[model samples]
Target: MSIVSLSSGEPTCTTEDVKAIAGANGFTITPGSVDETAFLLFANAFDATCEAIENLPEYEDPRLKPVIVDGERQCHRPDAVENPLNAWAHKTTLTIPSAKGPLAGRTIAVKDNVSVAGLPLGLGCSPGLLKDGKHPISPIDAIVVQRILAAGGTIKGTATCENLSMFAVSYTSHSGVVHNAWQPGYATGGSSSGCAALVSIGDVEEARQSGKDTRDYPLGEGVDLAVGGDQGGSIRLPAAYSGIYGLKPTHGLIPYTGIAALNPLIDHTGPMTRTVEDAALMLGVMAGYDGIDPRMTPESPMPDKVPDYARDLQAWIAGKEKAGEWTADGAAKGLRIGILKEAFDVIGLDPAVADVVKAAAERFRSLGADVNEISIPLHKHGAAIWTIAARPMMPHFVAGNPPDLLSHTMPHLQPNKIGQDYFDTLAHRNPAAVNILMNAAHLQLKYGPALARKAHMHVWELRDAYDKALEECDVLLTPCNNTVAPKHPASTAKTEDNPDGCSERIMDLFEPAIGNTLNTCSFNVTGHPAMSMPVGWGKVKEGDGRLPIGMQVVAKRWDEASILKVAKSWEVGGRWTDSR
Candidate 1:
C-alpha cells in the first residue's frame, strides 16, 4: 500500500534532481535504477507536503497575543549623548494604565533579545544579519513581558545585550559598548550588560550624592528593575559587575516562550534588580508554567500554585521580628552555608576578590549561621560538560532549526538562512560568535553526535553531584566573577593600519573572557537556582578604581525560597559596600 498516492498534479522531480540530492549526501544514483525511481517519488511527496503546509494558515498562541494600547507604541533609539553607557537599545514606555498588581509603579527595562511587541528586537547583533538590515518588530510579547504588564510593571525600554547574546564582556554589542555604571571606559559584564547597568545606575548615583567615596560618572535615566536572560552566566555576570542582584532561577521554573533562545536546554530569563526583595517580587510574577515553553516540566508549578515570594519573605521577616529574632546579629540564625572550594580555586581568581567573597561568606557566621567549605571535584569540569553538551546544538539553532520539542516557536525571529554576511559581520563584531559556529561544526565533523550524547549523559552526573553536595548545606557560595570588571577592549573600527578593524588572532579577542563564567556557568547546566548579590568592592585589573564584587548563592532545584531567605538575611545585616 502506498502511503502517498501519485497524482497528475504532483510536482515532477527529474533524474538529475535525484542524482544531485544523492551526490550531496555522499551517494550516487544510477539512471533508470529502482533507487532513482524511489527517490523521485519521495522528492515529489516532500515538495507537495511542504507546499500544502506553507499554504495553511499559521497558528499563533493566544497567550502571546499582543496587548493593544490606546496610542502608537512610543519608542526611539537614544544617541550616544543621551545614552552615555550605550545601555539602551531602544527607549519606550509600555504598560497597562489600569492594571494593578505587585509591580505597580515600578519601571522595568527588558533585555533586547526578549520580545516587546512593536519594538525592533536587535538580539545585539549587527543590522546586516537581520532582514533588510533592520531589526524585526516583535508581533507578540514574551511570557515575562506579558507577566510584567499584568503585574502593573511599566516597561521603560529594551536594554542592550551582547552580540547574539554570546559574549561576556560589554563591548561586543553592535550598538556600542555598555560602560559600567560605576565607571566609564570599563565593562559592565554581559550578555545582559544593559540590564545590569540600567538597574544599578540609579543606586550608583544615589551613593555618590550621599557623600560616598565613589567616582562621578554622568549616567542617564535608569529603570527600577530589569528582566534579564541567562545562558551560562549572562544575568549573574553583569549583575555582579554592576553591583546589583541577578537571579537565574531553576530550569523550567519560568516560561521562556517568545524569547530568543541559544539552546532550549539552557535558556533562562529572570529578574535583575538592586535589592533581593525586588528579585523575589519579580520572580513571584514571572515564575510559573505558561504551557507554551517545552522547558517547563512536571516539576514546574501551575500559575495559581506559584509561591508568593514577596509576601512569604515579608511574613518570614515579620515572624522573626515578633520573636525578637530579626536582629542583625541573628538574621541568618539556623541557616547552613557552604563555600564551594573549587569555585575560588579557579585560575585567574584575584586574591582581592577571593578575600572579599570569603569574608562575606564568613559574615553569615556572625549572623548565627554555620558556614564551612565543601569540595566538589566535578565542579572544576562543569564548564567543560556544559560547553560540550550545548555546543553541538548552536549551529542548528543559529540556522533556525531548533529541537522540535512540541513547544511554541517564533518563526519570525528565526533567520531564513545564514550566509556570508552573517559570518563576516559576526566575526568583526564578536569573534566569539564566529568561533561558536565553527567549533560546533568541527565537533560534529570530528567526534559526531556521540560526543554531545556523552556530554548530555554527564550533565545528569553533574546535576547529581550538585544535588548531593547541596543536601549537606542550605545554599552553596562562590565568587561570581574572578575579579572586578575589566576595561572594554578596543572597538573593531576600520582604520588605515587595521583595515578590517578586527584582530586576526582569536586570542586577541577572546582573552578577556577566559575565566569570567568559571564559577557561575556550572549551576546553569545543573538546573540549580543561583544568584549574584553584591557583597563588596575590588580594584579593577588595569584601572585605578574599584568595582563591585558579588558572591554567588546557589540552592537545589526549585528551592529559590532558601536562596532568597539567605540573601535577604545577608542584606539586612549591613550594607555590602561597607565590607570594603
Candidate 2:
C-alpha cells in the first residue's frame, strides 16, 4: 500500500525529519522504538489513503494549450567570449511579422526575467542552475512577449539584468558587469542594466562605417524599445543612468502577468526607449485588462482610449492636443508641475546634482509652464516607507514563486520554481540581497510583522501627502538621481578570511545610491505613474565627457497622458538627445 501524498513538499524526509515531526507535535518517537508493529500500522493507514485517493474525482487541466509561436533559440552571453556590454541573453532573431501594427520594424529586447519561450531566464543571480548543464528554458511566451510580437516588434534577444536583479548598480550580475553604453567605465544603474545600455548605445556610426547589416532592419542605431520590470526603480534608475527615456507606469497599468517581481504590491513592468514617442507606442500596445493579473478589475484604471499614445503625444508636442476634453492648447500651456523641495534637500545629495536639477526646474518655469516648489514633509520618508513596505515581502520572493496571473495570485509574490542557489549564495555576502534579507529578518524578529502592518498605514500617509500636493499641481518633479552615473565598483577577490566581505563591498555603493532612490521609491508605494526623461548631459566626472542627466516626473495615478505630454514638449523643444 502506498500513501497518497497530499502535495509535493520537501523532496526528502529522513528519519531525523520523522523524529523532528514527532517532536513538533509534542511526542517522542525513539529512533528504533516503534518497531515492526508501528510499521504495519502505518502501512495499513496508507492502504486507506490510497483507496481514498483512487476514489476521489480527478481535476482536469485548467490551462488552454497555448498557440505556439514558431521560433528557434540562439544563446548570446557576451561575457563568456565577447564584450561585457554585449548584453544579449539569447538572440532569437525571430521575426513574426505583423502587416499593419504601429511597432513594425522596431527592434525590441525583452529583459531576461521575462519569459520568451525557449530562451534562458537566469533571473541574473543563480550560477548553480546554469552550471548543471540543463538550462530550464521557458516553454510559453510571457504575456508581454506575445504583445510585442502582435504589435509587430522584432525581438533581438533577452537583455541582461543585474544579478538576481537585486542591486541598482550593474556590477553584481553573475555573468559580469554591465557597462554604461555612453561612457563604458561608469556604472549603468540597474537591474535593467542591459535594457538601458542597449537603448543608450550610439556606436551605430561604427556599425554603419563597418558596413554591417543595414538592409531591412538597418544598422548604427540603438534598440527602439525594451521592456523592464521595476520594483524599486529598476526601470527608471537605469534609464536615468544610461541617458534614455523610461516609464514606471502606475503599478498595474501594464500586466505583470509573466514577469519576475521583487514584491507583488510594488512590482511594475514598463517600457524604456530612446524617445518619448517610442515609449508611448510601446506602452499603448502593451497595457490593458489581460483577463489575468487581478490588478485589472472591472474598475481597472486605464486611459479613456487605448493605442493612441504616440498619436496623442505627437499632437500634444505640436500644440494640437487638449488638456482634457475641456480645452485645446492646454496640454502644455496649462500644465502645473510641482517640484518636491525635499527631493533636492536630501541630506547627502550631491551638490552638483542639486544645482543641475534646480537649473532644469528653472528652465521649466522660464518656459511659461506653471512650475513651483512644493513641500511634502514626509517625502524624506519615501525610501523608508518603501523599505518597510516592500522588503518584508521579499521572503516570499526568496522562496521563488512566479505568482502567475493565470494562477490568479496577484498581490502575492509566487515562488520561482527553479532550484535557485539562494541558499548556496547565503554564505556569500551580497550587498543587495543578503543585506536586505538579513535586515528584513532582523526587523521581523525584533518588532514582529506588526511593524509591517503599521508600515502600511504609514504608506497611506505618504500617499496622502503626495495626493494633496498633486491636487495643487498636475505632476511632481524631481531629479531621477542626484549625480551622473558613478564609476563602476571595484571587485574584491574571494579570500580565506574576507570571503563574505567581498559580497558586502557593494555597501560602498550606498553613499552615492542612497539619495538617488528617495524620489523614485515612494511612487512604488503610492502606485502612481513616474518617468525619467533625459534632459541634458553633464560631467559625471571632473574631466570625463558629459553623460546624460534625467529629470523625473511623477503624476497622479493613471495620468500617464500628462507625463507624456510634458516629456514630448521637452523633446519637441529640441532636447530630444544630447548634441554630442
Candidate 3:
C-alpha cells in the first residue's frame, strides 16, 4: 500500500522532534540528550521492521511521521556477529542463526540469564561470585534459546538483568542504569531492561531522530523477537511500562533448562515483543520437551505447533478469526470481570491512578464485558508472596554451607564477596552476635512465608472470585499500575539508592504496585497464562504524565491460546502499538 507515501508527506517525529516538543513545553529534557536522541532513532528502526508505522496514523503530526519512517530504515548487512554495545557506550551484541522461514529475516535479543553456548551468562552479577564464573552453558542450548535459533531468529546480544535476575530495575555489575528510550530522565524498567532498551533504541524511528547510523541500532523493530524469564513480573513490567506485548506462559509449558534461576517458585522463561504474532512465533520456537528440566510436563504441549507466528497473525488482523478462535474477547464482551475491591482499595496507588482504574472498569462495561466488584479479604496482605518464596531460597544463594550473614543484610542484596579473614570474623563472633544473626534469619524464613501465604491467599481468593466471575463472563480487566512511572533514580540523586526505596516502601505507597501482583501473581502462582495489553495512556496530568498504561488479561491455567486471542482483539480495537 506504500503506506509511508500515503501519509501526507509529513516527516515522522524523531527523537529530535520529541526534544523540540519537550523544550517547547518547558520540560527540561535530561542531560543525556545525546543518548536519548540515539535511542529514539533505534526505537523507530524496529517500529519500521514490523510495519508498525502503518499503525501510527493516530500520531498525526507530520514531523512525527518521519520518526517512524526513518526508524524503519535498515542496515545493508547484519550487525549480529559482533557486540553492538561495544562502541562509545557500554553497548552489547551477539549472533545466532536467523529465524526459520517467515521469521528468517528477523533478529532477537536474548536475556543474559538464559545461557547461550560460548558466551558467559553472568546474569548481571560479578564473575567472581558465579559457579566457576560461567553459566553451565548446556552442551545443548537452553530449550527456548535453541528453539529461537533453530527458527532462524538471529541473536542480537544478551540483554541485561539484575544480579541473578532478582530485581526488576536493571542495574547489573556489567551494565549501569540503562536509560529509557521515551525519556532519558525515566526508567525503562527491568531485569529484562536490556531487552527493552536495545529493542526501543535499536529501531530506526529512534535512530534517525538522534542522527546515529541506522545499522548500529540496539533494539530492532521489525524482526520476530523473544524475551526470557518472568518471576514477580520481570518480563511483564518492562513490557507494560515500555509499551510492548509480553507473555509469561503457563509455568513448565515452556522449558526452563539452560536458563539461570533465582527461585523456582515463580521463575518463568518466555518471550516479549512488539506484537502478539511475534510473541506467538517466539513461543513456538521456545516450547517443547527437554529432559534437563524436570519441571517440563510431558502432558503439556505447545498450542498447535506452527512453522511461523506470522501465518496466524493475518487472520487475527483481518478480524476474520472466529470469536472462540482464541480466548473469547477478554474485553467486556459478555465477559465476567471481577473488580477486586481489596486490590483496588489496598494498594498504595497514585491518586490519579485510582481514577484511571475506576474509569477503565467503566470502559470495559462500555465494551460489553460483564463487570462485578468483588472483595478478596486476603488482598490486603498480598506482599507476602515474595517473602514466602524468597526466604527459603535465599540461603541456597549463599556461597557455602556456613554462609556469610553480612551478604543477606546488604541493601538490595548486592553481593560483596568476602575473603576468609572477613568471613572468620562473622563465623567466630560472640554468642550475642550469633544470636542476633540467627534471630534475623529465623524472621525472614519464618515471617516471610507467613506474609507470603497471607498475600497468596488474598490473591487466591481474588483468583477464585475471578474464576467465578469468568464462569459468569470471560476475563478480568485491571489497571496495570497504581501510579505512573516514578521519577528516575538518578534524579533522586542517591548514589547508593536504597532498593527498598523502589521495592517495599514506594510499592506500598502506590495502589497499583501491591495490587499488580494481585492480578499478575495469581496467573503465575496458579500456573495459568496472563498478559498485560496496552489499552491507552492514562490521564495526562498525574497518571503516568502521558506515559502508556495497560489492561491485564488472565485466562485459565495453560490457556494462553485464549489470553493472546482476546488480548490482541483489545489491542487492535485500541490501535495499541508495542512501543519498545
TM-score of every candidate: 0.96, 0.81, 0.64
Misplaced by over 4 Å in model 2 are 1-73, 79-84, 129-135, 202-221, 301-307, 318-331, 402-429, 492-512, 576-580
Ranking by TM-score: 1, 2, 3
In model 3, the worst 10-residue window by lDDT is 61-70
Q: Using TM-score as the measure, name the better of candidate 1 and candidate 3.
A: 1
**Local accuracy of candidate 1 as per-residue lDDT tens digits, 1-580:** 3636632384667788888888988889888999888888888877776777788876778889887653678799999788988899999988888888999999999999988898988999866776566788888899899899988999999999998899998878877778898887788999999999999987888888887855666799899999999999999999999999999999999999988888888999999998989999999999999988999999999989999998999999898788887777888888999999999889899999999999999989888898989999999999999899999887677776757688777777756467787787777668888889888988988998899899999999999999998999999999999888988766444368865455565565678888998988878788899999999988887857889999999999999999999999997678886666
lDDT of 3 by residue, 1-580 (tens): 5434333433355766657756875775564678676545544554464465545432221211111111222222124333232111112233333334444657777777765544455565445554454343222245565566555566555666654554444332233444444444445555576666555553335446666423333433332365757776777766665666777877777877556555455668887877777777777767665544655565666435422335555555444445532222443364456665665664555566656556655555555566777664544544454445444544444333322221111111223343453233222111121233354468665675465456556555645654664564455555555544444443222236543222222322222223444445545554656676555554433234355565666666655666665565555335543322
Taken over the whole model, the C-alpha lDDT of each candidate is 0.87, 0.70, 0.51
Which pairs of residues have clashing backbones in candidate 2?
A: 124-164, 125-164, 168-190, 204-220, 400-415, 400-416, 401-414, 401-415, 401-416
Instruction: Say which candidate scores most in TM-score.
Output: 1
Show model 1 residue runs off by greater than 4 Å. Answer: 1-12, 213-215, 492-505
Cα deviation of 305, candidate 1, in Å:
0.7
Clashing pairs in 1: none
